[model samples]
Target chain A: MKITIIGSGNAATVLAKLCVQQGHSIVQIISRNEEKGKNLAQNFNAQYIPLNGTVNKNIEIVLVAITDSVFPKALDGLNFGSIPVFHTGGAVSMNVLRNTTTNYGVLYPLQSLSAEVEEIPTIPFLIEANSENSFKILNEFANTLSNNVTKVLEFKRLRLHAAAAIANNFTNYLYTCAKTYCDNEELDFNLLKPLILETANRIQNNDPEKVQTGPAKRQDVYTLGKHLQLFSEYPKLRTLYTRMTESIMHG
Target chain B: MKITIIGSGNAATVLAKLCVQQGHSIVQIISRNEEKGKNLAQNFNAQYIPLNGTVNKNIEIVLVAITDSVFPKALDGLNFGSIPVFHTGGAVSMNVLRNTTTNYGVLYPLQSLSAEVEEIPTIPFLIEANSENSFKILNEFANTLSNNVTKVLEFKRLRLHAAAAIANNFTNYLYTCAKTYCDNEELDFNLLKPLILETANRIQNNDPEKVQTGPAKRQDVYTLGKHLQLFSEYPKLRTLYTRMTESIMHG
Candidate 1:
């Protein structure tokens, strides 16, 4: 499939890489950011088109990977016609693409992507299409990029996106919190790596609730008091700690 | 080394297995629960002694893997005056073992353990001892069990344990929270696994703050509002969501 990747951001960069890697031709890179657009297009020697410019006629698909706030209006003035279009915002609705073209859907790659990451991780694509034929096309395309692709409904995709935030973003914040605490206490944060890895590994096979072990879970009052006493200066962590503890204990 | 394992619980089972795998001879298994003690002892054909029974004279070390609340008093009547005594409670102080034996320390394995887990993962042991000789002995013994071993001071060990609780225990709770939300929303929890694994893997090479990407970090008010709106019925999740969002945004 010939793709015109719109927007020169992390998602665009990663998806374009995967697309090119799978032997899909990137016909054009379309973006208002001329420098980034041209830089990304240089990799495939593809034409660089401005956002308002006419999308390449030969392109089979236009991937608009932009922020959630800019959706619907992001493709408002531009015309895609009957060409299949896929946007990659997790929170954005597939209906947002309805007005753009007769064949449009979402191809949300469910992972935290970054332009600077040397090696892109495996991406699980959540796909939704306007029709069964479009779904088949998108599903085949996504399969070229990743083995873990699922045809998700609109509402279910929204739920998955929210759950991804909780599982990935919130959990990373917890790691950051722990790292910060270790740094402040002059303890080596590196020591926590094995434990962190093990914790992550345990969840692969068992429910997190089943593997939970801590002072809070067992209601160890003395240890909890000691841990809490160390958090007098870290008011934010203290609050989060107390809330998590109570939730685990009483739940 | 000839060793006596005290208690017949998760930690006891795991450490005993590691000891046996490393070719150490079990002098005895002592616990108030005779059935569990005997069951564990049968693997090595070691004697199962009552809690009040004497520690085997030939045993070089006694591993008292008991609850923090039962510590100090748990071995009140038992005598192991000259032998090296090591306990496995993370929060319990090295000082707690001082009265039972002249040579005492802590061997805090910084990972969650369970009797049911089929394959025990790599463990990092944080050790502390009363004297230089005991430190050397404990370090050498720990090296037999795990490749990653560190001699952490008492205060730092406590801090490490607290940090482990944050990174592992708190993180696991977040996973459980997402899973529950997915279950109630009729979304497949397995779909979130890739995101979760990627989130965990990212922290291995980069700082969690550096790799942090989410609505809260980016200050996307629309998506945050949508996520919070979804959590309205879940008061606990809503509270955690808001707290985490604010923490990421402000700090």
Candidate 2:
């Protein structure tokens, strides 16, 4: 499969590398930044094109891998002929591409991608398309890179993105709060690493609610009070601590 | 070293087994329930004693490995005859055992332990003692089990516990909330597991604040609003979602 990836961000970089590794040909790499675009194109042996430049006519797949808000502008004037164009976004609907191309779809990968990770972990591709034929083609293309591919509609994909935000993004915020408290108290945040990893690992084989442990889960009021008191100096953390504890115990 | 464990709970079981693995003798296992006490005692080749029964006089270390509330009652009216009594609690202070024995310390292992885990993960032991002699003795005994032992004071331990509550407990609750949302939407929660594991693994080497990714972290107001609109039917999750999103974006 010959593909053209639009954008030179994290998502573009990850998808470009993975697609190349899966025996796919990268025909074009487009970005507003010339340096990043040239670098990514060089890595995949593809032609580097500026944002408004024309894409390769022979490319089978065109992937718009920019942020959700910047997505429309990035593909505003690009014409991919009859080729299937897909945007990699969790919350952006497939209709966003209606004006740009008739053969548009969504190829959202439901995993946080990082440049530093040497191996690409199992990425669940949540796909959507403008038509049945486009859907089948996107599914087949997704299967080439990952075994975990599913056709998810826009509304359901939005909900899944919400859940992912809570599970991944918000959880990392809590980690930041934990690290902040540790720094303030002159404690080593590394001490909490084992517990964090174990908690994540346990949920892989068991339900998270059933495996939950802590003062709130066990309803240890004294310890909860102590924890709240410990966060008295940081109002934001204290509020989060109290509300999350209440949610766990009573919600 | 001769040790007497004063409970049959998860912490007590893990500590007793780890101590036995380190070639230390478990002199006695005391609990209100005879079956559990006897079972744990048999596993370590130690005597099973009732809660009110006398412990072995030759025991050098007495580990009061019970819940924080029951800790004081377990040590009340019991004499260790100059043996160092240590309570394995994070928020608990060393002064709790001041009246029970002349030699008292804390052996708080800062990790969540479970019966299902066959091998003990790396557990950080936070140690505190009332005197220099007790501190050295407790340090020596802790060294036998783990190399990640540190002499932590009471206030620091309490704060560490609070941080841990967020990093582990509150994080797990977020997962529960995410799972609940996924179940309600007829989506497979398994799709989020790889992201969860990757987020935790990334933070092991990088600071969490730098690696945060989501709609809120990216300050995508449209996507954030869409996520909040999805949770409107579930009031508790809606509130948590709004507040946590705001906290992440602003706080």
Candidate 3:
């Protein structure tokens, strides 16, 4: 497919590279900044477009892989003609691009994409479209890049995004809390890696409830009190620990 | 090394199997229950002793892989003569076996072991000893089973256990929360596998703080408020969401 990506950020760069590697022609690369636009465009051997520009009419798809806040404004003056327009955002709804063109949808890659990181091939992409024809086009487009593409509605995708926040974002915060605590105590954070890996691997076969273990889960109030007391030096961490433990024990 | 395994629980089973695979002679298998003792003992072709029976003095090392609560009481009656005794526990202090024997130590595998789960070859074992000679013996014993073994002190091991609780136990709870939420909403929990795997893999190279993302970390009050309201049915989950969001925002 002849594709045009409407962003030059991490997600845009990574997706562009992957699409190019998959033998898709990137017709144009769009960005507000000319330099970033040119950089990505040069990599994919596509045309670079600044703000207040239009996508190629011949391109099969126009992927609006930009920030949520700027997406609507960025598409205000742009025209994709008959090409399908899609945004690569989890939280943002597909309707955000409804006004941009008749053929609009969402092409969200459900993974943390960073330019510095190696590309992951099997990320589940949640595709949504305003119409059946557009849905097929987006679905087929996603199929070429990944095997794990699912056509989900906007509401279901939103719920999935919320759950992702809990599992990915909130869990990462717990890791950050652990790392901070370890750093302050002059402990080796690397020692926690095996535990992290094991916990994750356990849930692959067993339910998380069945595999749960700790002071809170075991109801070991003495160790819990000790852990809470130790957290007094870090007030924010103490609050988090207290709240989390209380939720686990009482809830 | 001639080794005798005490208790036939998950840790003991895994350790016994690993030892047997390493061509070590398992002199005997001891458990409070005769059935489990016999079952484990049969695997390694070693003698199975009932709780009322005597210890095998022929064994050079006795590994007391049992629960934390009964560890002290169990050690009180055991008579291993001059044999080196070691307990596999993280939070239990080395002093628990002080009066029982002079040659005592700790050999804590820093992974969540289960009898049903297939054994992993490279588990990080935390070794601690009451004396230099005991430590040397435990070190040599650990090197035979796993390549990654650390001679950690009791105090440091305690801190590492706390870190493990955060990274493993707390993180698993978050996963449970996500799964529960997904099930309640009739969404496929399998969709979360990629996100979970990626989150774990990212920590291999980047710090959790640097890779952290979501509405909470971004301080998007609107999305956080929406999520909290959506979680009103699950009061405990709601509290957790609110508290975690506050921690990430302030931290």
Scored on chain A only, each candidate's TM-score is: 0.92, 0.92, 0.91
The alpha-carbon RMSD values of the candidates against the true structure, listed in the order shown, are 1.8, 2.4, 2.4
Quote the positional error of residue B83 for candidate 2 in Å. 2.2
* Best-matching candidate per TM-score: 1
Instruction: Tell me the spans in candidate 2 whose CA falls farther than 4 Å from its real position.
Output: A33-39, A42-45, A71-73, A99-102, A116-119, B33-39, B42-46, B116-119
The alpha-carbon lDDT assigned to residue A59 of candidate 2 equals 78
Q: DockQ of each candidate's interface versus the true one?
A: 0.77, 0.69, 0.60
- What tens-digit string does per-residue lDDT give for candidate 2 at B1-251? 88888889888899998998889989999888799899999998899999788767787889988887665766777887688999998888888888868999999999887655666778889999999999999999899999899988888888888898899988889999999989988999998999899888888887888778888888989788888889889999999999898899898
Model 1, CA-based lDDT = 0.86
lDDT of 1 by residue, A143-246 (tens): 99999999888788887888889899989999999999988888888888867777777788888888788889889888898888888899988888898899
Candidate 2 displacement at residue B78 in angstroms: 1.3
Q: Is candidate 2 or candidate 3 better by lDDT?
A: 2
- Best to worst by lDDT, what's the order? 2, 1, 3
Angstrom error at residue B97, model 3: 1.3
Interface RMSD for all numbered candidates: 1.1, 1.3, 1.8
* Model 1 chain B lowest lDDT segment of ten: B112-121
